[model samples]
Target: MSQRNYRAAIVGTGAIAHAHAQALLGSGRAELVAVADVDARRAAEFAGKYGGPSTHAGLDDLLREEQVDVVHLCTPPQLHAPLAIACLEAGVTALVEKPPTLSLAEFDAVIEAERRSTAHVATVLQHRFGAGALRLRRLQEAGELGRPLLATCNTQWYRDEAYYAVPWRGTWESEGGGPTMGHGIHQFDLLFSVLGPWREVTAVAARQARPVDTEDVSLALVTFENGAVATIVNSVVSPRQTSQLRFDYERATVEVEHLYGYTDDDWTVTPAPGQEGVSELWAEGRTTTSSGHDGWLAAVFDALDRGEAPPVTAEDTRRTMEFIAALYASAFTGERVQAGQIAADSPFARRMDGTGAPWEKVRNP
Candidate 1:
């Protein structure tokens, strides 16, 4: 691919949408063509701030009006898959937000849509682009971590009732799940992206919110296909903190101790004195790519520029969504959800729409 300026549009103008706009604008690779949101004011605000193109009512209007070559879907989880598919159908490449869709079925829809269209498709897993993420994968693949054994991810964030006051939030209908889907998903995305797939999940969810039906606290045990076990603890009850993940392997234990984002010193691969030196040797011998643009859209731009696939692909995201779906099923049924067996309309399917935990506990704290 020859070097050329790319035109792009962002589909959401909410809190996270700003990052998309900024990343696209600053990357010196793609231009901020347009942004759309249901709230016209929000869309207009983003349009004014980011420059270029224009805003429209919703995704349909935006897609119909803009001659955009790339579409960045930063909408809520439920809208990601459909909008992505819509973009692909329009012959436009797409980069969707995290927790790609409400279920694996929807993700499969995105995949099929990708197959149906010539557009490049990707899941927005920007966390996988971080410097730590880049270096860690190199070590793991080179056997620096040996055979990974266990890992833990803790994502605890605090949000007041006012935060959930947004109509779509705290409801299973709009935002997908609660903390596990909204907040904690970032850390775990990095987890599954690096550690690979899981075989089973045992989870427990609690309603600690003010008056929402979605879970506020959740804990789960994950068994990876590679014979590794991991634990996940996600909550909205603690003080504001950064997302973190710790990986334990046969040769080393690596950790990202910072939340929001981290680059230097946030990750470490430990060794038994001199045993894992082989990994160090391998790392020194090769230099790949690592970047701070942790969103899928910017990474997609780079991939297009290089004629390569994005680091986080649709199948990669499906694995995490697969884990999440199974976790919810496991929580509701109080049983172990065997991987590959948890499918749509399974016996353990929880009432997916505003019917989980408690709205009360989620509201106050």
Candidate 2:
């Protein structure tokens, strides 16, 4: 494998960009050499904090000037695809933030661009990189944990009015859907990583509180291809915040609870009668690395060095993104959406609320 160091750049120096910048620096194989944001002053500030790499007004200018190996897209949901496509065109890997695109249509466009480019696009669903998550996948595949029977993925956090006061926080055109797209997507992505593929989803979405254009809360019942069922809840109104996922296997029950990110310490396994052997499997190959941008970046760099596609590849990201679209489609249409049911022309594909969010109709009426 190659041992060459990589040049890295970051676009959109928002709050999430800080994590990307730090992760790039921590990777040891990559350097933060450039950054771009529409706000020149903010870009400059971000540059100053992170070894003062060059700052540009936008990705186009940054691309023209810097020859980077990877560009981290820390911009909002809408900008993720365009910025990533630009990176792909430049033959630079794009590490995009969650809700990789505003809609399935946009994500497909990015995927098409990727097919035509030499570089790749990776979504930053960092929770899947934790040591515990890795161990879980390994054990499950090795048949130590038995078949998955049921699961629950809940991302319940509090976001007040002030949080949505930001111009783009809660809008469909800007931030996409509410908690389901933004807050809980990490949990959703991590769940998909464990559960394999989903068959169908029945969901309901609502704007229970917080004045926003999108639903602040959503609940879904999903059936997986493996014959397992799961419940998912995404909300931003709960005062006591937590991100939790529980998987019930035939042999043992595994769970992880935390907010934002998690490590091995956050995971616990409860074995079924005579299934205590699974604990040993879970304990093997444990690492101190917590689930976060840093670990994900490390994996990306490793894949790049090995001349292989990185984790959270287009197929992986598309499945999770499709599930998000399916959740919204099911909620908006009051129908159970099957996998591969959403076509390019589907309203949900054109936009998250292609059929229009129910609450938006009531508000306008």
Candidate 3:
């Protein structure tokens, strides 16, 4: 098939939008044709800085006027579904940011919209595309790591009261859940990508620091279907910020440690006992920096050109979202939540905090 340059656009001119713009421009597989934001000035300013892309005050105008092949939805969590649906309905593929939607219910709606449209929706879970992560996955799939036994995913970052000054920063209705949904989600998504589907989750959530309606910290014990258990900690109260994931397989232990993003150097492989040769095998393939949006976008464009479903498809993202729902459900109900337990009617599925925001009643410590 002849390669065609894909035309792209970005919606929502927020902080993350810049990353999207950079990745789209750098990917070379696609051209950023336009950018849209509710704030006309912000849109115009972003366009001025990004170069070449036109600007629109609203997505309606951009979708109606531009012939865009893909759109990066960089808006707040609450706006992801509606905006993504709009793009998909307009026959444009959508690549949404993390916490893809405020809740699983909202995500389901996005999936239904996708079924009726020619275009597809893919969530941004960039960590899965990193070179180290990809290598780890290959080793695991090849049975070189043996059967996975244990894992840990920690997203410990600091977000002060000032950081929540943004209207949607720490709210159940807007930003979705706190660190579990927003920050740690990247690490956990990568964890799930490597470990596979989770079977159950038991969790606890708290408003440990920030005076936000959502919990600033959460901890969960997840049991994967493969019988491997993982301890997950999501927190915005830690003074030292880091994104870490460690998987202990039968033959070797693979670990990645970095803040925000990672590179080849961030990954380490330690063999168990007499299994020293595993280290050499782990380094056998291509070595590249940690994958980011650019790496994922390159793959997305390749899939588009081939008329294939893009990476991080809704079905793929649903596992991560389902885990988020199960975490919140288990935390709020004080019960172990099983996968597929959060039906459409479940309060946690409908909203992150269940029936009501817990922090609303408790005084911030």
Candidate 4:
């Protein structure tokens, strides 16, 4: 007997939703049966373009009409939590976009919703699904890389004023945060997955040169639970753009440089003086899966087929989300933040900027 194929739907017919549609079609494990968008024309156009899947004006209508096994919440950052909660309530899985929720408190609520339902919620941190990341993690877990010591995660991309003119491109209330939360999250999530949990974060954020309310640039010094120290830089004001991550282990230094997604060729493993053997191990069991929405969804589909929770589980993603919160907390508060420190009552838990960003005064005045 053939394995059962699942039915999937895309909730927002945006650019990212197209990626989800393509991935769903390519997976062979799922079929795109329906899509929903607030704009009727957009939904119809997306449906027509992608095999004429049924289209609806809203998620409620889609849920009411289609027997969807999973719903890809490709909407804006702010809509992720509510839509995901709704999916959970309907006993349907929700594969949400990154920065899963606007705040830690919002994420906790989504977790609660998941607990009450038979469904699960997974975030789209596609970087962790790449071949390079998978290989590094496998080697690191097997003690092939020795101990991790230092690392750097940098996302330096340029976005002009016209990009921020979209209204939702840069705002705490709408988009959740600046580049730290929106753009650089992929690199840092991969970092967190490889290094385990973080211990503390000291950071700073500035609007820099962007014509927006949120910071265009932010930097941080992070200490991991395993004693590895890493520096992070998130910026949208750089002239030249690149997304880079470097991990310096006792035996080897691994690095990948790419602007967006990465393949195996983008990665390099340089062994220590006496640990030249590490390079061969790095290239031995490699696959061609590049980091993107498709590869990540494939892993998610595998878990669903096994009646298991998805790869980027809520607990694992919460750690990364917490790190994001802590980065902003430390940046705006001018104090180092520790893991499990953003209590429900804390301002950072409610909002990324806590009471208000320090630069808010300068911008308002």
Candidate 5:
């Protein structure tokens, strides 16, 4: 594919939208032709800050006015599915942020929309694009890391009441399932990329610290199809915060420790006895900075240029979302949930909280 510039637009002007705008501007792969938000002023401000692209009060107006080849859905979780569907239907590819939708059913709807249109939709699982992560995946696939036996993923960060003051921060009906669905999902997505499909999960969740309808902290034990086991933790109450993932393979233990994003320096490889050369092999790869929206945008633009579906495809994103659904189902019903257990008709398929809002009872008391 020849190197050609594609016109792009951002659909929401929130805090994360700036990251999207800067990434698009920095990549030189796409031109930020426009921005849209419910607030016309916010859209204008975003345009002014990021090269003065056209601005509109809503996405529909932007879509109608601009010749956008790609649309970034930076809106809240609830709006992700519908807006993405709209973009794909109009023959424009969509790149959505994490917690792509409110439920598994909604994600399926986005997939259906993609199938009906020529354009494709991709979710933002940026951690999978980092050079360290890419190299680790390559090593594992080549059997250089041996077999992945056990792993731990933790997204333990701090979020106070003031952060939840946003209307959609804590509700199951809007923001999905708190940190498990929102914050830690980035780390878990990276874990899934390395470990592959999960088989079953058992979990427990609670609204221990924050006054919200979703769990502020949750823990789950997951069994993978490859016979590997993992313990996953998502929390927003920790005073000492970190986003960490540790994988214990037969020959070496690979770990990445960083708060938001990670570079090569943040990764550590400790080989077992007689495997001293593993560290040198781990460092044998192209070096790039920590993965973020910029890396993801580069991939998305390349895929578009090649006329192929981008990275973090709907099928891949569904596995992560299904794992999330299984976690919520297991946490709420006190049962082991399988990967395919949550179907379109299942209670958890409709909402992350499942059939009841257990947190509601505690909040009322």
Candidate 6:
């Protein structure tokens, strides 16, 4: 039912890179063909740890050296665009990490590149395909959940001074933005996936937490194109580890919580008045998903096998980026940034340069 396995080449051997490589190895779906990084030593180190993936110092060399069918981009947000475009130019499909672009313009650039290149491209917004979300989709489609209404995304994650110690971790130039674009964005992706394309937004983002260059806290009021309004709160400064989406629909309410573990069973769907039997219908449509990152990689491979594109495309991610860019602009500029009103020329297009925001210093006692 499938063609031969597609070979794999990974870029950016960061912490998460190893996880992806390991998943690929474990899946038996693709071969570890090559790896590239700015630091040759790091590249070699990763290649060594894995199965001798060819190591390269940069993209130009890697693209020329490796016969990789797919490129897994594991770099920081700011680097995503150029590297992905280069991969496209080399006629390679790219599975990029979250926060697909630094700005809406860069997003358009990637989409344009994909349009022009021989390569079909996709991004990693992996949460939706999770077993929990998958079941939710089925339940909704089956009309067990009826018409969905309100949605809420809450992620209470914490990052301290140490987390930002890495040179690129907290910088606007390298990381794109703050937590709204980084730590909390995956959760945002999950929210958007379930809630659908959003309409107008009013948000406030702030960099009040650590020595970061972007906001650690953001609250947004967003309306969906379907006229459903949702409230979102994202932060890296909050204590307690939890993630949740509460979907209130016409027939029932469905919930998913706990980011790292569990599945559709985690959802407790409550049907509308006198519709108690809907719970059984929701439960009957159970599913299981590979770990979030693993599921995405597997899904990509599956799509490739099926001659279809990965579920999350550059255009899909661009919508998310557009909202995020608007969120940052709205919060940073103290204005209610308008969606669709934001163009490639909008201030959010480029990295936040020379904001003169102090690199918060912690007095070493």
Better of 3 and 4 by lDDT: 4
lDDT of candidate 2 over 282-337, digit per residue (tens):
88777777898887888888899888778789999999889989999999999999
Candidate 4 positional error at 218, Å: 0.7
Provide the TM-score for each candidate, comma-separated.
Answer: 0.88, 0.98, 0.97, 0.98, 0.98, 0.91
How does candidate 5 fare on TM-score? 0.98
The global C-alpha lDDT for each of the candidates, from Candidate 1 onward, is: 0.75, 0.91, 0.89, 0.92, 0.92, 0.77
Please say which candidate is ahead in lDDT: 2 or 4: 4
Candidate 1, residue 260: the lDDT equals: 69
> For model 1, how does the per-residue alpha-carbon lDDT over 44-101 read when each residue is reduced to its tens digit?
8778877746989887897888888788788877788778888989988888777677
* Per-residue C-alpha lDDT of model 6 across residues 112-212, encoded as one tens digit per residue: 99999878778777776777777777667666666778988887788889989988887767777777777677777877887778888888766776876
| Window of ten residues with lowest summed lDDT in model 1 | 347-356
Error of 1 at 225 (Å): 1.5
Q: Candidate 5, 48: how far from true, in Å?
A: 0.9
Quality of model 2 by C-alpha lDDT: 0.91
RMSD of 3: 1.7
lDDT tens per residue, model 3, 1-365: 66778888999998899989888778777788899999989999999898868988778999888999889999888889999999889988999999899998899999999999999999998999888988898988988989999999999999899999998888888988899999999999999999999999999998887878889999999999999999999999999999899999999889999998898889898999999989998778756655778888877878888898798989989999999889988888789999988888888888878866555655433
List the pairs of residues colliding in candidate 5. Answer: none
In model 5, where is the ten-residue run with the lowest total lDDT?
356-365
